[model samples]
Target chain A: MWSINYYGNWIMHNIEITDLKRLTQLVKDNHGYDFTNYAMSSFRRRVNRILDLYNFSSVNGLIEKINTRPAFVEEVVNEITVNVTEMFRDPSFWREVRDHIIPNILLNHQSVNVWHAGCSSGEEVFSMAILLREMGIEGKVKLIATDLDNSILDKAKKATIPVKNMELNEKNYIRFQGSETLSKYYKEENGVAVLDPTLIENVSFRKHDLVRGGIFNKFDLVLCRNVMIYFNQNLQNEVLKKLHESLFKYGYLIIGSKESLIWCEIANKFIVVNNEEKIYKKIRD
Target chain B: MKKRSIRRSGIKYCKVVGDLGMSKYKLDNTYRAIVLGGSAGSFQGITKILSSIPDSFELPIIMCLHRLKHVRNGFVEALSIKSTKPVTEPYDKEKLKKGKVYLAPSNYHLCVELGNSFSLSTEEMVNNSRPSIDITLETAAYSYKKRLIGILLSGANKDGALGMKAIKDNGGLTIVQDPNECMIKTMPESALQATTIDHVLKVTEIIEFLIELDKNYK
Candidate 1:
């Protein structure tokens, strides 16, 4: 195995492409978690991080752990998937949603159906909830949030975030120009900001793997921001198709500000509503 | 776009001759990509380098520069104002093309994948930087191997030191902005200590070198 000395202290074993294929195949066969479709570079980096975090000597060592302990697969899955997210990330996108997209959605539909695909730790779902509440349409929207990792989905259900992250979230909220201060929505308890439970009360949190899961319901707006960045072209096309199918005809699809649908199979079906914020309107069934 | 196809042919030729080892090439037309890493005081230097390069420069230029995590919109536009070639922040999995410039997006760690595409991560910050110079440089080193040109510029910290070392170790050409001329020498000085850099050029000299390299492609 090839290794590199990080800071001349710890040697990081380079997780080769062949090793990734082996690990992904093993996970697919044994645990039924399909990670083969993940973008190889980022997935390999995450696996490399796991090796260092757990002090595994090599990829084989990680494989050994996966083989011996059935419960360890959950831990591996958690580590493999990235969960870094914040409230009101890319605040301009949120602003565009409030000023234009929501009003546009409400014009045709009395009640909006929203899906927060890959909602990590619930910041974004809560952000949407708060936005709907401030618009006085909280009761008029049905929200469903899903993630690949059950642990993170549980955290999302909890609606609590560390106090340290609140400052950045608050800054983002201000930039988003919300109806009220972000603090008005959450309470501080023992160094964690506990969001108002009412905000997420109607929201259903589920463990849905975008790669393997089927489309359960059609939505008026689907926010799968920053999630598809982890997927390869084949998986992205597949997921985009599922996302497209999950949306009602002419419904809105808002992705991360930097994410694009231009290169995907579904590109021709969606009209670019707001290019800078990456808001799209599905034009074709 | 035609330039890109030509560059692609160059890449295929490089691969055919690659097993013979890269050190023998000496910055010939074999290089496929150019990666640059900078921090604190490097923006001016980088902009100067970017603005100076001709529009005909064919190598894909990938940059990892430290910027505020929350503030995202202005950097690319600012870089584009004077750059001859358009500057862009590539979306995740976007393929790298010749004759284009790519900046690491804010709040994301930009990585160069083996397939000549970008893979971004929300992974924890390395050396307190989201677009960690080390990650970009190391990954670029791995992907491009000897066909990469890595340049370290002025910065307050040592984020790019290990990256420069990686580029050097992978038989890629390594360059650092001259410490004496840098606004803040910590970054280049750190790289100088970390590895044997190929050229320690001033900003103008770096621009000239790039122009000369572009002429070779012509």
Candidate 2:
């Protein structure tokens, strides 16, 4: 099936193996989003989604537009990053970290440094702060939260949450054995919950790209939840290596409930602390 | 070797110019096997039939269900809750086993070639689908030639009809859900007209027939 390719979009009856190779090249050359080892099905759907949104009559047209417009490429790349997250997302996972992972850190390390990579909009940072405070470990914890999106970081710094999300947020918070209602954490006015400044006193929000580099020395815990699923396997493995290097000896790494280190080259470096919660503890080399 | 012939007949062949380095397997006449393809309104009927079959039932059931891309990982959980037999999404290179049902994940084509082992490919969208009904049924017909039972259930397209006909031509059983009984009848109706279907039954009767076949044959 012969086809014309412009920026990885092919106009053909079937997706040729040659087309995939060309797509890989185009992504690298133009967008810098190397999708070479991403699951093929996932890569196809994302391309299709982009085509639909752009309202291109065919893949050819979409490619033409993308080749001509750099902003379009940026939008498409952002769309591909699935950044869906929630506050204190999995309560059980947080509980496991608090009970099992944190105590081990307290034993060897008098002070702790934590990095929450891909920390979208700071709900999770606040949640982590609350956890540390409740444990009387807040003073000992230093957190540096970063994500690729500066807009999200701005929102995170503001600590303002949409009013509608508060009800469910409160429910999830209480389910996590929160001693006080979520309403107590933020005063409601003008349809926004301005998070208490105290929760983020030791926390710093920055624009850090996982695909690029994070400028932090060492940390006890790296809580990167629900952010890697959208990453191509190569990117996932690369990011995992960076996280592995960043963790202090015997430090912890936590991923999404569904995410795993099984397929990574560094899978043997960490022992699973809680498999279902996806909490892993770094072991000595 | 003619492009015109392929375009006219709706069947195209790409002669392997060189070895693609894929391992090949061969099998002789296999035992009775069921291959099912459905989408759109497939979940209810498929879950019911799959969940009703016992683990003791001695046949392999390969199912393809269409799903929205990147859906949560509760399909096995849901199907396991509903099915009497164990339902699992196939891991890459996992060997095929009997008495267990395999469900294709949201966005991949699931095919069974010779040797009864399943293969997943992301080559292209067939009939506008990744987990295409036609791809699954067609590959099974190519492999199981005579022992296959191809079933077309509730779906919104004509994906399985041509593949179902291939199964019948290979001396295998071709079944379709009675159009009236199907939540979406276009696919079942397509199969009935395009192929020599051996049976057209309601979902309940299909389950009963499977049970009876398992009891008598196995």
Candidate 3:
């Protein structure tokens, strides 16, 4: 291990195989961004990508660079926590959310509290909003859309998407059997699709890290699609535990179509409402 | 060897070119995966290669092939007929194992997810193909690094060239099928031009090389 001076501070610079936990700890300590709970394989892969992208000598050099350049931390956080999602991502999953889960959630409560955790860029949040509006329950919902990456949250908050993305969005809308033409929800001008601002009237966008953020509020429906697959099993279990705690008793949880809760300890705590679409209902106490 | 005996056969084999260097093909201790990619006139070559592998071959072989989007079934089943190792389309989040051949499911780009399992994505097609050869190869290179083996076979497009180069850049072994011996030389020709490939062998030699690699790893 060697030492180096960068930006008038002695940053630890070494060529050894730096411990990933140590790196994340350094980030947590210096930047207050916690990543220790992430799966190491992906954590390591992203670090390696950063090393390649920036031509860092090693993980130490990467950390040293991060220590010196405060602005780079945002880039790192954005890349690491990034989950690319699409509107109506899985057509059938949205169908189930509309037909099966939403009705069940509305059965026990006057309104629905839908939490879109790790809601990258708010695609899923918009999907849920469309469903709620179509179901005539838009006025009776509180939707909290949260992610660790604030830049993405900002984009989601704006709720406007590029016009080109409308092709697949419209395709999915049709596949989902949405009540109205997909164009009725958004106006296109100057090559941009402007969603109705009212779509997000009840939606709140916030920055929240699923890895460390504990339970804060209860939700009748929690849609955390396609995010946990990025996490290792232990972290998945921990986050699922946290999500389980955040749900109202017998509240519905709809995961990504590809994500499975089969091996999670909470698997027994939820009944499989629809396994293919990955919708589960909390077991009543 | 006759190529016409295979299905959709447009395969034509020329002379097996220059000798494969034994030293450079070394399978080191860290090696863990064997990723093979191909398109357009690849079935014959892939079948021949898979059929030639010894029963003792134990690497987790992942294959990405560019077929028409409408190919719903039988691609893996066809390969399993000739593969001594079992071949099956991978389910989402399916765990990896040795001595198995995993096919990238249609309409999805396959990625090596965090848990050493496979994840499928319907993200927009890349290089005009859903099961983009480059996406799978690049992700495998990232996950396995120096422990990866990426082999690009015959095709009509330039999908796997950059990805095979990525494997080489990451210290993983890189192999490309001999362009002169392929039915459609565009893919292999592109890959050969992309990076300093370690091996450029014919279908049979590639198969034997894989068997040898398995032995070396053990």
Candidate 4:
């Protein structure tokens, strides 16, 4: 029930932490997906939104669906995942990846292994692919793009973004000072811009939940930009450890320009290679 | 109001029943949060409203003010000066406090998540704005329910319209600054047209109502 304490009257939501745990348990029991480690704040917001969208009477109603209709899990996955991305989002960040990180990666290995974790809708992945092609290393790269949602993975595989978004994407590309226009990598058709299939030939799109997934492979660089902000510190540490273990010695790790590794358990393992670009280098094994 | 064809998804959520005035509105200090949204010409309106709040008032106030996406704005510093209460840009996962004003950080969509804490999203721009009022209000209304007091002030676009609806639908108080008094009237007018507002007051009256409303809990 609602109560007033040091602050004025604080309204306690009918749904409590216990309910969330029960719901997480229910999902894990049924679908084998663990949301227990995911950021609960955003998780609850998404749950309420899904409840509204599906017109479920309560959180209990949503739970009922989880127990019975396994097919509805796809929809739940799509809605819950925050898939915000753009083609060269934060131009300066990409500029650093192109100028410094890529060159650094080349100095260490002939064929670079790049992991784009939480690659929502594949915008960042495709942008990086274009960068690789520009740097003349597209043939030597093994890129894997992964996210928790299968539906978004399908969209990423298609590599088509809205035509209207291309203008902003183009602006970002120019600001990033790409060798050529962003249009060189994609074909525009019917208000949609589709990326060249060849660019994604080396990239594998997979459904991998960072919160629950294990280490899939070692990489020369990992780009988990703009994803962990949805997570809490504990989860960030958990996932950051996974990233740390996945990187080779002196490899690169790039996060969103706004995201940080400060206070994270593995923070000391990484040193900021480029502070403004938010690119870090793994100094130790 | 033209098309009252507003979407109300579930009774589990919120719905604004009717347009209300200051006298018609009832306040018993049950409000845990007061959310205000504004855009163009809002800096002045926000200052006036925050300056009017008394030192003893004790509700956590949140604001989503639209700004240049890339500009490093002194918005928090400026607002902190105008407000009697402590104001700062909340760090990720910072607990929402009483008698404090939290401004949305630049380029981040600020959401009030399930806990009494703020969540930041680098999500796509909504209505061409990063700190979209609709997104913030929807998130806060979902969390706070009827305990929220959402105000849509001066803005250029229709950003806060549906957000005001979200608050009203969940049985929270919804107010819009009178469009006539707004420097840029589209935002408030947009809110008015979409949802029948609860309190259509001038900035001065809004501050007065809020101060008196805070006394309910005191």
The model with the greatest lDDT is 1
Tens-digit lDDT track of model 4 for A161-227: 9897788789888988999888888898988998899999879999898988999899998999878
Tens digits of lDDT, candidate 2, B1-218: 37434432431121121135221111222555788888778788888788676668887888876765334378878878878887877643244676778877655567663455555544345566657776677667766778888888998977777778878877888878867778889888888887788777678757755765566444
Candidate 4 per-residue lDDT, tens place, B1-218, comes to 32222211321122232122232245786789999999987788789888888877789889999976655347678887877876787756667888888888777888887768777887556677787787789789888999999998888888888788878878988888878788899999988887768777778768767876876877
- For model 1, the stretches where C-alpha displacement exceeds 4 angstroms are A1-11, B1-25
Among all windows of ten consecutive residues in candidate 4 chain A, which has the lowest summed lDDT? A1-10
True-structure Cα RMSD, model 4: 8.9
Best by TM-score: 1
lDDT of 1 by residue, B100-127 (tens): 9999999998989888899887766777
> DockQ of every model listed?
0.35, 0.08, 0.17, 0.18
Clashing pairs in 1: none
Better of 1 and 3 by lDDT: 1
lDDT (10s digit) by residue, model 3, range B1-218: 24323311322221122133343344555688889999988889998888888867888899999975534567778889988878887765678888888888766677776447876655446667768887788778767888898988889888888778778878998888877778898998888887888877778768766766776666
Each candidate structure's TM-score, on Cα atoms with residue i matched to residue i, is 0.91, 0.62, 0.78, 0.78
lDDT of 4 at B193: 80
lDDT (C-alpha) at residue A269 in model 1: 96
DockQ of 2: 0.08
For all candidates in order, the CA lDDT equals 0.87, 0.70, 0.76, 0.80
Provide chain B's TM-score, model 3: 0.86
True contacts kept of 4: 0.34
